[model samples]
Target: MSKTGKSKHRFPEFTDADAWEQRRLGEVAEFAKGRGYSKKDICSEGTPIILYGRLYTNYETVINDVDTYTELQENSVLSSGDEVIVPSSGESAEDISRAAFVQNSGVILGGDLNIIKPNETIQSTFLAITLSNGSQQKELSKRAQGKSVVHLHNSDLKVVNLSFPTLPEQERIGAFFQTLDATIASHQRKHSQRRV
Candidate 1:
């Protein structure tokens, strides 16, 4: 807060905007778990699918494209394009704290993934970033449970405390991160191509 009650830290455009508000993850979002599918189910070409492992390996802030495919099953969990997904299980608690914003609908979200669907109060990309790399990541890491194989559940995520600006600010922040990730990916592709 500043002398005028606006936020002390903000983008130049939002200098006059109000301060951010605090809310629990459960207050602003609903949770679901991905279902079905596994590594053996992957096929050369079929319906696009995002397995839990992809959240740890292939994705960052946003998952706009998918290269893996599988034959669609009856009870597949599909992305609504507004979901923030985290791997439900991993070798370590810290490793399972990552998340990605699902940018396409109808893509199957495979089992062992926790899905967060934010309400109109927050942007999906922003929420994904919050859980994946922001201050809340450490909190989430602490909530994860296991010994040999750590697991994160919807209940664990519900109590997370998060702070957010207005929806417009969230959209701007989300777009900024999305563009940043795209640029990094582009450079990585070029570097790999040169190496080959």
Candidate 2:
């Protein structure tokens, strides 16, 4: 394991920085099971939608581009732009616990999503990255059932350990990854266009 409990790379400047604080997901964030949307509830054009399954398929560690929208009979499922949507169920245990940071406001938080809204001290992107990273995901995945339609409950997420550094360090990590994600997205767009 690397310093700060990371299993991989660390910022050069923060190599000697303080060790990251370790805490359970429940201790740092509020979690809620998202509202389930029926097949009838989903639409091609309407309020932007984020189906929990999309966290694994469409997004990387963070989601800025919302491609699908649906009309909800009730509009209670909306993001304030900081919710981290996690898959509550998947085809395999390894597929569970995948997450995406939602920064776009007004997007609907669909069902089968374990939505994590981190408290004021935690950066949403950093939390998203930490969860996206292999370590935390491994811990969470272990709790997921591997049988058909594997599921991870809100209770399961509440106990997953998350390691994080100081506020400033978290900011740096989040900013760095955000920029990296943007660069990757830009390149992907170009690559797709080239093939067209």
Candidate 3:
């Protein structure tokens, strides 16, 4: 708010900081497409797996708790922290490119997903939120192709531009959202329990 009230990341710790820098999604990060797999490959008990389809129906803006597991194969590379999961295919433009942030490693990434690996320029949680931001989602929708199932490729994802603050500011903003999301989930659960 540097006297202009133009919106800035002003924390008491770094009150005199500059505004966030703008960059394309491709500049500070790379979108890696997850490997292919079939339902036949799924198992009742094994290593945890991040299925792309679940990005639509099962996840929130960010995911910290992953409970589903599948059989771990030699090629089933696990996800590392700071990687965001995005659906490659969906029934509509809005559903396409829906995202989730993976906070830890070890869960195997499955087919029809694009993993957003943000580098030092941005935090993974921040990147995830920006990817799912309304303007970005609209861009994704415009880039998405198909008839019944909308599809977004790595090439399509690279064009979305993002404005990010310093690492410290990103850390603060991302952590705040994480805490807020947890609180919202807690309230949602309490509300659901009352309904039951």
Candidate 4:
């Protein structure tokens, strides 16, 4: 037991199984795959966009352009505060577990990415942080399977275990992390300016 009266890595301090709730990813949110867009479809102006290829280890939403699409590409819709994860990639299996929080609106994800939209019960930031943690990353790496190219599916993420507290607690945790992220962003901006 640690100072928090729980294991050094454990969280929320649950007393028993009844104290914690188990829910599928679908139960708390909707998981959808991204659209497959051709190279010609990408434009210099229009709707915001996000491609799994651009997702980094950090949860930064890297936009290549302001292109938009007229037709509704399958599984391309994404709202703000959604969790975007790359389950399939050309990189190593361990690298495909990268996930990010969508802080921008009207952004469409490209194929190779899975978008998870929480159903109001969970905080998007909290979910992103939880998934990015070392423990969860290890679990995700274990579940990822593929011979040539590693891949993960919606069902795989749905069954993954998650720990949570009450809604209020979730909000507090999310806010605390958000502040930390902001601080990091500020420092990054300062460093970039120094390089210029």
TM value for model 4: 0.73
Question: Candidate 3 — which pairs collide?
Answer: none
**In candidate 1, what are the lDDT values of residues 83-136, reduced to their tens digit?**
999899999988998889899999999999999999998999889887877678
Candidate 2 lDDT over 1-196, as tens digits, reads 2234543567767754467778888988998878867556776788888887777767877788888877755645788899887888889877886778898888888888889999987889889888877688898778898577888888888898888887878888989988998899899999999999
Reference-based TM-score, model 2: 0.87
Q: lDDT, candidate 4, residue 124? A: 78
RMSD of each: 2.7, 2.9, 3.4, 5.2
**Model 3 lDDT tens row, 52-131:** 77776666767767767777777765788779888888898888856789887888888888888988878888777767
Residue 159 in model 2: shift from native, Å?
0.7
Ranking by lDDT: 1, 2, 3, 4
Candidate 4, residue 103: the lDDT equals: 67
What local lDDT does model 3 show for residue 54? 73
Per-residue CA lDDT of candidate 4, range 1-196, in tens?
0111222432453333323344655678788787776446666665666656556533442222333444446665565645545545646667777677776676767677777887777777767777767666677777788878887777778776666555666676667777887788789989999999
TM-score of each: 0.93, 0.87, 0.87, 0.73
What's the lDDT for residue 158 in model 1? 92
Summing lDDT over every window of 10 consecutive residues in candidate 2, give the lowest-scoring window: 1-10
Alpha-carbon lDDT, every model:
0.88, 0.81, 0.77, 0.64
Range of the 10 consecutive residues with the lowest summed lDDT in candidate 3: 1-10
